[model samples]
Target: MRGTIQNRDEFLSKVAGQLGQRSFTEGVERPKWKYQPQHAVLKDAGSDELLEILKMQCTKIHTDFFVSGKSGLMETLKTVVSNYGGGPILTWKDSRFDTIGLTPLFKQIWPEENVEINEWESSRGEENIELAEKANVGITISDITLAESGTAVLFSSKDRGRTVSFLPAKSVILIPKSTIVPRMTQATKIMREKVKNGEHVASCINFITGPSNSADIESRLVVGVHGPTKATYIVIEDL
Candidate 1:
């Protein structure tokens, strides 16, 4: 009964009478909008074009962007990790890391054996938060890549914790070229389709534009206020 309407025709009949209508009915057609400029922006751009847009937006948001093939992604990831001072790395428990062939080098990605790596595990509960807070670098796979704002959309679930992206000082995000879309318009459409098709969409969808910054303290801007101070995005071409 959670999703069921309590009243059948009684409530609708009263409302219809007030509106001077005959009867209330289900499945009313949605009205088409007259001005739809949302669809006009970046209309049907190719993935390459979208990537270029993403790169350009990254400059304003203070994020680094890189393009790499499947073979080179591992090395690219390693370079990002090294740039962040050789973690204490935290990542999601995602199988795509194995599918994209990063699993093989999981142990030896970093040349230094002293580097510690951790994965977010739902089984661990609040223990995951502590690791994320202490981690130097946190890595995550982008659920959707918004080309317009250079945003990485993260779908949080049992295996993927939200804290992994925010608690860390630095974050490295892996984005598949195939997942890139024109903007929020396309991004929301995809999520709507997922719900229409009865897909299990995660409740918490994160639209992280870049390293967190705010101009609230003064008119002057301050970076790394609430979230990551520095962020890097690795675009996997052959995902």
Candidate 2:
């Protein structure tokens, strides 16, 4: 049996020799495909029109969309928290949130209560993860939102961890109207520029379209199996 198997070595060697002699393309330039601009439809669309389209698309996918101005942002956030039944909220510690002055509002709502409010900290990774797992609501600020698909783009980093959006039962995202684009190509172009400028882009860039849903078992739908069951987007109109 050993001698018979060894006989196949010659055949394997012949195959290898034949493969080695094959010529492969070298430095061959292929013509690139040309297509119409993807976001041309949005070029003439006003901000109000874009916002309406985004809101419609987001609602179609079961995401609650709230519109507010810079002055009304805190009030909108408070209303969102109250609607979610308040307390046990997890959020990122990014300065954009600080500029929005959420800390005082959170403290006012859940003052001195242990485990009621947890902010992402670079030094307290394990604690933050535990808080995220148990939190009723998680809040994040999105880098961009795509109007065509109603998708929000989040870039995770030390300031904003991935679990803050994925581990909670309900997730809330704050997006500026100025950052809303017509399609994904524009959003990705902006992200590419950020990466090129030596910004600290994280290994994970999340593009969340809607709540986590699965229809794999028995054609019945289940929500929040892998992530948040519900998502709410607050679009700041006057940012």
**Predicted structure with the largest TM-score when compared to the true one:** 1
Off by over 4 Å in 1: 1-25
lDDT of model 1 at position 46? 87
Give per-residue CA lDDT, model 1, range 1-239, as digits (tens): 12677886888898889999978387787799999999999997888899999999999899998999999988888888888898888889999888888875565655346778888999999999999999999999998999999999999999999999999889999999999999999899999999999998998999999999889656688899999999999999986
In model 2, pairs of residues that clash are none
- Model 2 over residues 1-239: C-alpha lDDT tens digits? 12335656567667767888533335746576586577576877777888888999987778998998888888898788778877689989888876766666666656654437878998996888998999889999888888888998998988788999989989999998887888887887797888889876667899988788778758877778899888899998765
Stretch of 10 with least lDDT, candidate 1: 104-113
Which runs of model 2 end up more than 4 angstroms from their true locations?
Answer: 1-32, 37-41, 112-115, 217-220
In terms of lDDT, the poorest run of 10 residues in model 2 is 1-10
> lDDT of each prediction vs. the true structure?
0.89, 0.83
